[model samples]
Target: MDRALELAARGPAHGPNPRVGCVILAPATPGIPGRTVLGEGWHRGAGTPHAEVAALADARARGHDTRGATAVVTLEPCHHTGRTGPCTRALLDAGITDVVHALADPGVTSGGGADHLRAHGVHVTAGPRSAAALDLVHTWHHAVTTGRPWITLKTATSLDGRVAASDGTSQWITGPQARAHAHAIRAQVDAIAVTTGTALADDPALTARTPTGTLAPHQPLRVVIGHRDLPADHRLLHDGPPPLHLRTHDVGDVLAALHHHEIRHLLVEGGPALAGALLAADVVDELHAYIAPVLLGDGPPAIPPYGITTLATAPRWHTTTTHRLGDDILLIARRTATHPDPDTEEA
Candidate 1:
């Protein structure tokens, strides 16, 4: 599971393909009951090597024979051919006999890796820690299958779900811990996007600046939605990393532009209107709501204008994970398979 989680961390950095982690487990003798982790490998950098191949090499280096060993992975290996050879071939070559996976690869180019392995006399089991693994690469997976990047609507709001004070003073609604966690999310995704309205209103840096005063060298691309021209002095645009100016009227166009940029994962750090627009367009794939325990009844609502008509009409999502960051509750939700009416416009 640790290997799987670590593998997921590789995705945004490696474009097009989701990062994977693998571990080879060798059964212990009578003296040692639990299986020993013989070797572990993660996709290190862009175009390096696949996770399974790396893990096998590690096992060999450690003098651990992988013949008949059990391999645990975060996602199913690739069955079809790609830039790298099929992972199924590598596993077979490594003499791995058993496989455990968290989730199946949803890509058309690599869907049946597990089936291919089973056909080749490998025992495969799936769905153990699958949800957690999927959560990590949810955006990437969504993009591969849907032809657009997955959108995560993230906001820091008060206990009453207000994003700002009544007078529009919205700085630091959540504590330090929640802000730190948000930065981590920004680092993981391909782009940190917001609307031009948000850019004008907040003038946020949008770059993932860590608490240690260190900036992520390859910070996510900052994108501003909408066709409105940004001010020459826009803080987000003038920062160290240049922001992408996307002139689009609709959320779908924004998503298409992001896809063109090879941004498989997008974090929407909002100003409500953008969030509501994405949700209304049914383009949002996941939501990360940071609910701080405070109340400001007259403040701006977490989401903007369009009142979600009904629970049924609302885009269906599944709660993937909920963690506590300081006094804030971080809730993560993924889009469901069903799509409501794509033709309907938001009120």
Candidate 2:
């Protein structure tokens, strides 16, 4: 399972399909405590062979007799055929006797593989390193399950939660290390988004770059929100991937638009207005804050109030990690529990 996950990370960071990996193990012998590894493979991207099939093909190419082998995979082997044949069929054809997988596919079109495999008489075991496996593809799974884009909100603030000083200068709220770490976050997602007010005020290029200031191999799409138009001399108009203008005030609309653009994970770096709106809409999946040691008591807060009047009404988040980046402290968290279902709520 560990090797499968490592292989899964080798696939593209953004694509229509979730990254998956598979490893085939030769049947156990009388004296051997563990089976020998036959082959390993991972799903490259859309329109490619799935991890199970890829691993099977690799085993055959190596002249290994895979009869009664065990298949260990990061994700459940897919049961249905889309761009490729069913991985269940491939595993059966390869004479795989047992299967072990991490997470169950939540996708409507790609789920139910475990049950299908079990019904066909293959021994299936689930839940090995499931949490870690989910973390690798959480954004993809969320997008698929909800039919919308997954949002990761990033903020840089002072100890007082102020985003800027009285002069409206926020260029150095956090130290260089925290800023560099934020850029690394920008490089991993499908898009980096900000409101038009932020774009105009900061004039940020929003390009992820190496420590040497060169562009990273994976550049996220630059997205600007709000109904306002960008100036002709704007840096966003001329930097990195072309800027996508989402002229809307509705948070749901913004996510729907991004979803159509193949944006599974969107990193939002907008200001208070947009942040508060996302919070009120309950659409933010992850919240990342780089808190500096300085106090800025007079400027706008990093997040403004958006109708939360009590503790019960306020959003809940669970801390995932806390790291000290140079002089700043970074807080990484995910939403703990969403609002109760409308049908289940009391009057």
Candidate 3:
């Protein structure tokens, strides 16, 4: 399962297809007790060997024989041909007898990889950490299957769910730890998107800032969504490390453009209206909310006015995980499969 999580972590960055991670487990040697993780491999970048092939190479280099090793991966091995050879064939060539995957591939070109492996005489098991693993690459899977970009709504707010002061003065509401964590999330996405209100009000740069010596460099595309024409002096419009741009209104148009650019993962940062609009459009696939410990009783609300006339019209989502980012609480959610039955009360 850890291997699958690792693969999911590689998503939003791996191009063309979401990256996957693989771990090969073999029997312990004389001095070793039980099974040992003989090798680990991750999709390097575009135009590189797939995860399973890379794992095979790593195992061979480590002097670990794969006569009957078990392969654990985040997604089912690809059965169809692609930039590289079929991962199923690679596992068979490596003499791997068993395979465990978190989830089956959902791509039209690559679905049923598990069934193909089973037919090839490899023991296969699915549904181990499948949901969590799928969450990592949800955007990628959604794009492949539905022809749209994966959208993640990101927000940082006070413990009381305020994003700014009553007068709309919001600058660094969260502590350094929470802010830094937000940057890390930004670095993982293919694009960092913000609304026009946020741009006009906050004038945020929306770029990921890493600590002085972190090896992984952040270079996500900067996107601003709204109808307002941004001034040339806007900080985000200038040439810099990561590319920047302004996307016009019409969520569907913006999504189509993103898909054309091969951007499967998106991070939506906002001042309320933006988030509310995406939620209202029923286009948001995921949510990442960072709640700080402090509160501002008369500050800006976490969500902008959704403009829904009644409670029945409100959008409903499912909470997936809640974790701590320093003193702040992080809440992750996914849009429910269907709009809530109006008669059902929200928990």
Best by lDDT: 2
Which structure is stronger by TM-score: 2 or 3?
Answer: 2
Model 3 misplacement above 4 A: 1-19, 25-38, 63-70, 80-83, 92-98, 118-125, 157-168, 211-216, 227-233, 239-247, 289-304, 318-333, 337-347
Against the unseen true structure, what C-alpha lDDT does each candidate score?
A: 0.82, 0.89, 0.78
Q: In model 2, what are the clashing residue pairs, if there are any?
A: none
Clash count in backbone of candidate 2: 0
**Model 2 segments beyond 4 Å from truth?**
12-14, 30-32, 81-85, 119-121, 338-347
For residue 47, model 2's alpha carbon misses the true position, in angstroms, by 4.4
Which parts of model 1 are misplaced by more than 4 Å? 1-16, 25-38, 63-70, 80-83, 95-100, 118-132, 158-162, 165-167, 172-177, 291-301, 307-347
Ranked by TM-score, top first? 2, 1, 3
Candidate 1: residue pairs that collide: 159-294
lDDT of 2 by residue, 27-46 (tens): 88998698799989999987
Give the deviation of candidate 2 from the true structure as CA RMSD. 4.7
Name the better of 1 and 3 by lDDT.
Answer: 1
Q: Is candidate 2 or candidate 3 better by lDDT?
A: 2
* Candidate 3, 2-33: lDDT as tens digits: 85467547634645677688889994467767
